[model samples]
Target: AYFKEKGKEVIYDAEHFFDGYKSNHAYAMRTLQAAAQGGADCLVLCDTNGGTFPFDIFKVVQEVKKNFGIKIGIHTHNDCGMAAANAIMAVEAGAGQVQGTYTGFGERCGNANLSTIIPNLQIKQHYICIPENQLVNLTKTARKISEIANVTLNERDPYVGNCAFAHKGGMHIDGVCKASSSFEHINPERVGNKRRFLMSEVSGRKTILDKIQEINPSVTKDS
Candidate 1:
């Protein structure tokens, strides 16, 4: 009523939705209905404490879709290290939208990492979030956001991280040397990143051979 009077849009964030659903599933459904009745354009189910696992997220979201028959969105945090996975699972289970931040930057453990989610959606799952031409800027955008926030980027942050594509173990490097896809989930360059062969004590003969060939094409493992 207030929003209608003010002519403003309503986007109800169902805060602590996961916990609420766990406590009383019926009550949570009612709350969503109430929000929809009050003119919410989007109903965002939130994992406020970030404890919801991916499986539960998927199941609950599936139920929500069946019952409500309305558009659903997902908002997750990272306390349990399942935020990104939870968001992805929700979308897989029928969520129309996902709420996240660049680099997963937020309070406490942070929000779902759009950096990870974007590539997993567009490249792997074949969902079109942005144009193909602009996908390359994802890594650069993540770094730029970190710089603006005056925070050092996490090198292991899924696709955009410096070490996300780095391989170090002997067997892993061997697999990558033979077939990049064997050791890598996606081609790093697809997201403006690069595959890196990290030299370590775990280096195998294949690793050494690949490195030599990079420096001099005429070199062979036999030599």
Candidate 2:
């Protein structure tokens, strides 16, 4: 009512109740229905306990969609190591948007990793939201948010991680040098990430040549 008085839409986070109790499909359904009736723009189902499995999430999401004809969103935590999977299941069940922290950093195991979710949605699922050019800005946005929060970035994060585009194996580096798609699922440039060829026990001549060429294309092996 307050929001409506102010001419704004209301959205229930639905975190507190889920965190305090175990999985209650009935409660979730009732809450969603009530929110929809209350004029909510979207109903966000939060796996605050972080104990729900992918299949369970799918079931609940599907039921909610059948019950309410409103838009659905998902908020998952990483406590059970299935946050990403549950989020994907919610989407498959017709959830339109996913909400989470940047590097899965939060109060507990952290929220769903947007870095992983974004790539999974765009590359694998082929869903379109922002412009292709703005896709690269996703990484920049993550870093900026992390900086503001004074949190260190994770190196192993799927698409936006520092090492996400790094190649170390001899065969992998060779293929990437010739054609990035040879070893990479998606071009790093597409996400504003730079491909790195790390020199070590696995480094090969092709890797060296590629790095050198990148620095100075005019210089050849003889030069």
TM-scores vs. true structure, each candidate: 0.88, 0.85
lDDT of 1: 0.90
Pairs with steric clashes in candidate 1: none
Using TM-score as the measure, the top candidate is 1
Clashing pairs in 2: none
What is candidate 1's lDDT per residue for 41-107, written digit by digit as tens? 7788999999999999999999988877668899999999999999999999999899999999998
How high a TM-score does candidate 1 get? 0.88
